[model samples]
Target chain A: MILVMGPVDELVTAFFLKHLTDTKREYLFVDERHLGGDVRLELDLPQGPSGKGRLRGAVHFPTWRVGLEELTGIYSRLGTGNVEQRKTPEARAEQAHAAALLDLFPGPVANRATAMLSNGSKPCQYAAILAAGLRVPDTLVGGTWERWEPFARALDGDPVIKSVSDERSLVKQVSWEATRASARPGQALAPHQFQQRIHGTNIRAHVVGARHVLACRAETQALDYRHPDMTGHTVSLRATELPEPVAEACRRLSRALGVDLAGIDLIEPPGGSSRPEDWVCLEVNTCPGFMWFEQNAGLPIARVLADFLGTPLGS
Target chain B: MSNQSTDAGLISSQDLPKLAEAGHVAAPTVGNSAAELREAVQAALAEQWSLMGIIDTGKKASDLGKKAADALTDKGKEIEDKAIHREKDARDEAHRKMNDDKAKKHGREAGAHGATTNAFARALSELRG
Candidate 1:
């Protein structure tokens, strides 16, 4: 059985529920800790189509002392709390606590809380994906006043700066480059992640099995597609298989992070830099928007999930 | 003092030390009790929400709010894990079944898959084994 741990925002929860049913799967969602433990396992032990099914049981542990006899797999989807609602001190503490708990799971955890963090933050994710021999963009993460100023000054006004770790985490998500951006040397009030923005469409790689890479490109407003003002681009989902090395890297990254799967986001920078060595692996999403990506990418992710858990997906 | 209580004029952060000095504050509702403060803050926020929106989530409780606040303080990485588990269960399941079957059919391939994709392929191979 698999367990879901976050508050399960209404929209995200509804999407998963729909997919769970569509894929002929059932889940035990846990947001609060019960008397014994705070965990939820999506049990499917009932003897049904697979014949190998057993007497099912689902339980979540605030700790991982419990057994894993009927266990099959696990998923981590929790994220930092909403930002705008929180205050300064509360926000910092909350994010730090979230990071710690991310590091603190019961047993058989995926997505290392430590591995998930980086000095470069999201840029580090891209670097890791690249180092794993995957296709990634020619990205850059700079905070040095001298080093980044040169790059920023020369670039077309719209480069994307992903704040390392908890920078814009709480505020409106720092998804893309600012619409009205201004850059002055030393104007960086806080440390920031400045990557030479990719000018291609988004490719959301829903990496499950080793070679099982469901790659799909999403449309957005401008070059850095995730920008808030991106409404002109109409999303058209299609499944594009990643090359062997890139696919292999997707698998390797999941392994390195201790997660069996991830939603690896990438970009095909404008030029023919589409080669394996040229593509930029943006970030690895531990808890990606399954419904949104599926809708945009048109991958049979729900079905894939249902099959994984021995239930029916998109059922 | 909690944020809500402070907002309600029940007790101010400055008054907290005085209240403690007067031996009026409880263990779970004071300066060191960050959780209690958070609850009060949440309640205060909720009250604001009540005024801004319709205030439908029921009135916040001092005790419950404190508990939530305390949990919030201590809930570090668990938040991310919760997010993943909550959203990815369905997909993870389907992934398990297909990969597990792949394990039975293609051991070496599954091994490579696991090596490449972590336990995803490894678990599939385990099922096969």
Candidate 2:
């Protein structure tokens, strides 16, 4: 049975569960919303590589019990809680227990927490992206004002700044005035990521498991399609095709990053030969919110995801 | 590109702290019995009816909602439809603003005096691993 873990009210998780139910797939859901009250989990993990070291546990719902051994795959969308929520004993326990199972499960997990660590550093992900034979835009992370001034001046266009890590920040072009203001003596500045803005069409490719690639093109004039409202530009999405090599690179990148599922953002440069090298990879999202793409582009992402999670590992 | 600067999103900097607080507020859990909660959850699944039909389940969740509402013997179908539409609207609104909300929250926190330095340092260490 597949184990889907997340809040039932959440769009992605809700749709996933709906897909599984509609398809009559055998599955169990650990609702995160009422974890402290309605759901309970227990795990007993021992050290060493002996047979007893295998994961042994069960998740208990109000009227049903699901053993770890019964699960063949797991798809977790659990978000980390803040300091105060972390202090809540029961909720904290369930979150930690669920997280541990996701981490230690021998079967297929959409993403193991360890694999998702690369998302913490965009530069770190860039190395893997490059290894997968994709180009990454020239990027500078966390430099002094005196150091960045020369780099920004040399850019062909205004440099856009974003959060260096997975921390969300809309792509914004730093005005020369803002750049110049940092030069004043004793003025404090946060270490932000500045990248040479690449002009191109936005393509989001969702790579599932090893080979399933569902891609869509975002038609937008906004600097960041995700928040087009911020730039007063509306956005639309449509299913698109990717060249084989680029799609393969996406698969390789997903494999390299150790994510069973990934949402890779790519910029297809205008007037370029359709080749993997011509595409600029922005970043690989480990836990992508794919429902938006599915809703807009009419892509069957949830169905594909359900099939992936329902299939037994190594089958 | 225009020279005029703008905030990262519709969320102003002043609202950042409040958003952070609101994000952490937990939803209240139901105090019903197991059977009642299960029945309620199954009924709540009816809300999926108004969603885009990605697959044809032969009349689907809406049919189920209508059946349940019919069993209630009130003007329940209309009320159910309205609730579903309201939920769908809320979800659409949430979907559009989700990224901006996260961006503004992170931007506010990371803009603090030394948070970026510490975060970057931690990132570098993670990269080294």
Flag regions of model 1 displaced more than 4 Å. A8-10, A22-26, A33-67, A79-115, A118-120, A135-144, A154-158, A166-189, A227-234, A269-274, A309-315, B1-129
What digit string (tens of lDDT, one per residue) describes model 1 on residues A158-251?
4565545423221122322342144454465345555555666677788664435778766554443442222223344567776666666678
For B3-22, candidate 1 gives per-residue lDDT tens digits of 34322332211111111111
Q: Among these predicted structures, which one has the highest TM-score?
A: 2
Clashing pairs in 2: none
lDDT of 2 by residue, A89-197 (tens): 8977787677667767767788776676677779989988999999999888877777777888888888998877776566888876787765557764567888999
Displacement of the residue A30 alpha carbon in candidate 2, Å:
1.2
In order, the first chain's TM-score in every candidate is 0.65, 0.91
True-vs-predicted CA distance for residue B75, candidate 2, Å:
42
Candidate 1 has a DockQ of 0.02
